[model samples]
Target: MSSAEDLQFKILQHPNPTSPEKRVELMANPTFGRVATDHMVMIRYTEGKGWHDAQVMPRGPLSLDPSAAVLHYAQEIFEGLKAFRTKDDGIAIFRPDANARRFRSSAERMAMPQLPESLFVRAVDELVKADRDWVPSGENASLYIRPFMFANDAFLGVKPASEYMFLVIAAPVGAYFSAGAVTVWVSETYTRAAPGGTGAAKCGGNYAASLLAQAEAKHHGCDQVVFLDAVHHRFVEEMGGMNIFFVFEDGSIRTPPLTGTILPGITRESLLTIAKEKGIKAHEEPYTIDQWLEDARSGRLTEVFACGTAAAVSPIGAVRTKDGEVKIGDGTGAGPVTASLKESLIAAQRGQANDHHHWVHRVL
Candidate 1:
């Protein structure tokens, strides 16, 4: 943990905060990433001083030099976590320390200075505390936290920048899948990550590379896109933004093993822990799309789902390709396995079930 003096942040209040009526209207139909809160947390870094000049300021535009490193080289990393308003009207964040650790991992991968875990967590906590009123209390509604670091050095050289900036922004969001369960398109054409790549890192470049495939999925009338192993294109990797799982009728659940190609999802890890506690068989191994189709046809595969911070656990009803489409479950509804897992996971997050894993971190 960083010392309190070292992690000190300058606080600045918003001059023109949103009114209650307007904020309520926005939260009533808040889609993902559409609106932002009044304030943002920021900290700057230099080669000589490391991370410094932390502040919470009004949300506005950034004035950057023409030769800013992030603009030219795309050196940036980010993380996503949410703060929930519990039944008792207290606020808590789900697995924020996990996000802090992953943020450091992404910083290392991007060749940027790592924000101290304590500072990162404190930044989120302070911002959420100051903006607790921005947290929506409706069902499946909460405050979304986005912490990001980017190179800010103004130089034309194609090397790692000597200066960087870390910022945290918040938004009140409704459920990611407000429409319901989604059908994902298996992207046989575009691969999300290679064996030796930034797939494991939560960097902007990896997501930029996935947008084309995601756009194609939308064109094909699908909600999300799933990628295969870049080398063989035979094994399942993950969705564009989520980790995937397959459940067998015998009560065994399988997810793709971490081959240094898949992002180690916090939600996926939590699900594994909960599944084991419930005596469900959970296996992490390489299973190809063909095997999944075959198992589903033979009545062995009972449920297919995707997991991430944004969507939590969404049942994958069908996997579509140019050749054909394979439906994993009986109908458009979540399977028994998916339902149980989703219920337990959501219950733990919402404070409805005992948090034996101690995954929830209280913010306010």
Candidate 2:
């Protein structure tokens, strides 16, 4: 990894840029993870050379060997964030430094070379500058950034790969769901994380393992799946790709604490900070499904929601099980607290409000 002062990224402009009309049409209703920008950022790392050849070039497919370690061993990790177009015709990223830190942690876990925070931020800045027009300013829309690292060594070995590639891609994404709030099902049959496992890391394998349970949730007429601990399947771990939170009627918010078995979500941490600043009671502790059901039935659990970079904050309608179902609140839509928190966070990201926390990083 290069030092902050020595960091430099070479730019290779794409010859064929997407037409303005087509880009506008796509941005009008840009769904999540669908359309992509014209360019991407890539950097390579090897055993002999630490990190080199940082470039921003045209977006395309990668040519990899059949025996690439990422293909066989699933040695890959990814980070998600967004670049929002502010009202002043400028763009800013939400907590990109935090994402960069988490990316380094993920790299350590996956045995991949960790890129310096300055380099990661610079890569994002360069790509966003090159594709600033792709960022959508429409309501609930922004340019999503995906930074990923993977093992690229072709040698067939059981140990970690000696070569790796780090890449960042951008996508113009709109709302995750067309509706106001989405309903999710509790996955009792599938466990997302175990004690002393890789749950804390945002790796591809964790998501790959939850696909089946997510499919089950979809089959059960739900938008997403909520997973539990692998040990007893009692404590709440997280949703398929988001963190879960429970709002109690006693004017307190509770979310499962970081037990080394849940992804330390950026949105989750941001919400906690906002809640504290707003004088909302917040607790980080374990709460079982049964307890949640009981509390909801007794009007103690006021609201349920999930948080992530993709879906800023989404209200969870109900939790269904084989025995019975627990419907939270009136199930009409988002609660007041959830709505307020979401608005504040979005405002900070979009540069619409005072960013007292200094969470937004200007990319251009």
> Which ten residues in a row are the worst by lDDT in model 1?
1-10
Q: Each model's C-alpha lDDT?
A: 0.88, 0.89
TM-score of each: 0.97, 0.98
Residue 68 of model 1: what lDDT? 94
Q: In candidate 2, how many Å is residue 222 off?
A: 1.0
Stretches off by above 4 angstroms in model 2 are 1-5
Which candidate leads in lDDT?
Answer: 2
lDDT of 2 by residue, 142-218 (tens): 99999999999998879989999999999999887666667778888889878777899999999999999999989
